[model samples]
Target: MADIEVTSTCEEGYTVESVINGEWELVVDALSNDGPSANEVLAADYASCYIPAFRVAADKHGYDDVGNIEVDVEADLDEDDDLVSIAFDMSVEEDLGDDEQDIVELGEDICHVHSALREELHADIAIESGV
Candidate 1:
């Protein structure tokens, strides 16, 4: 078993900063038109996670050196500006292209981020208020 954690702070409106391993990793300003929104983070993370998983799946299928596979992840939001759906698209390098569907399935099965997404988003709320 392995453990991972990231700290997110939203001290300024919709802007959030994520820190990992005591280093500032990502800064997202949801209120800014040019910055990445929360959903964008999800999409990017999905693709980032899947890319490695894809490599693993390909290796498992006896494919060596899958080359550089391009991936695009998109998030669709409703009129309320809430994340409603996520879509993943990728172009596998010809050198390792085989059973794409199986690769996707295996990738999702192995990717930790994919696993977290597959599981329901449940949080055990903890509150600390000082007034």
Candidate 2:
């Protein structure tokens, strides 16, 4: 398992932190008193998984110029219960010739993170779109 450690500091009215061994930098609001909750962690995991999957899918379908891809993941938590549901959505800009379906299919097939999460945590996932 991969391990990460974060050290946060209050700077400019925000909690700025650097995640050790992580590629992206994160900044949180200090005044909100809400940071890096369980749902946020889940969403970050899902989003991180999607980046490589999307890149591989685009390359396999001959989309050599797959631009930046953005993924949005949401986890719904029950207020009075312990059930959690996750939803994933993504937007990718690529230059492919009549192979959009193939790219999308590849992405769906390689999204192993969601499958692993479902098995480990018995969570429900709602996939709005593959691409």
Candidate 3:
């Protein structure tokens, strides 16, 4: 059996509905004008995974909490609309000072999505602390 499974179906145009683990559902529209495009969903998923991974990294680095973290993901597409690059603008409610880079690195190491993405698409991250 697979460790994870997702079933996606489309009855009509660009819209697709996905059932995850047979419990949760997600809807996406490829046109994006109707709903979120596949790229947008991928960005959201990266952010969701990175946020908690960052917190866990902070904890491992000896900080109990990093406080309300936010991430703004930017994805660039080439002429063919193929994803070319990704960037992350991250902000935290607490000051991490010099330990920030280490935490970010560890977070990337911990995030499954980060590992899953192509090497060229690994995010260029900028973090703002105490914001």
Candidate 4:
């Protein structure tokens, strides 16, 4: 059996409803005027995966209480609306000081979504201390 499975169906227009692992449901609109588009969902998934990986990386770097982290994901698209690049602006509650870059590297290494995305699509991260 496959480790991951998702079944998606579209009854009308560009909106699709998907069932993941036969338990979770997701709704995506290709145009995204009514709801989140596919690219938006992918951005969210990357952020979600990154947060925990970042926390683990912080811990491994011997810094406790990294605190609340907020990630703003931005995707650049081409004329055909194909993704060209992604960037992450992260705000954290704790100051990482000199170890920030190392922690970021470790988090990127650990995040599954980071591994899944193409090298060109890898997020250019900027972290700000406070908030």
TM-score of each: 0.76, 0.56, 0.95, 0.94
Clashing pairs in 4: none
Scored by lDDT, model 1 comes in at: 0.66
Query: Which candidate's TM-score is highest?
Result: 3
Q: Report the error of model 3 at residue 43, Å.
A: 0.9
The C-alpha stretches of model 3 lying farther than 4 A from their native spots are none
- Candidate 4 structure quality by residue, lDDT tens digits, 1-74: 89889999999899999999999999999999667999989999999999999999999999778989999999
lDDT of model 3 at residue 102?
95
Report the C-alpha lDDT of model 2 over 5-86, residue by residue, as the tens digit: 6655555545456555556666554343546644565568766875687678877766666776766666676875333776
lDDT of 1 by residue, 10-122 (tens): 77577878887666588888765646877777778877877798789877877766676776565677888776666665666544334655766777778887778644331
At residue 24, what lDDT does model 2 achieve?
A: 62
- Each candidate: what lDDT? 0.66, 0.59, 0.92, 0.92
The 10 consecutive residues of candidate 2 with the worst lDDT sum are: 121-130
How displaced is residue 66 in candidate 4, in Å?
Answer: 0.8
lDDT string for model 3 (1-131, tens) is: 78879999999999999999999999899888667999989988998999999999999989897779989999998888788989999999989999999999999999999999999988999999888
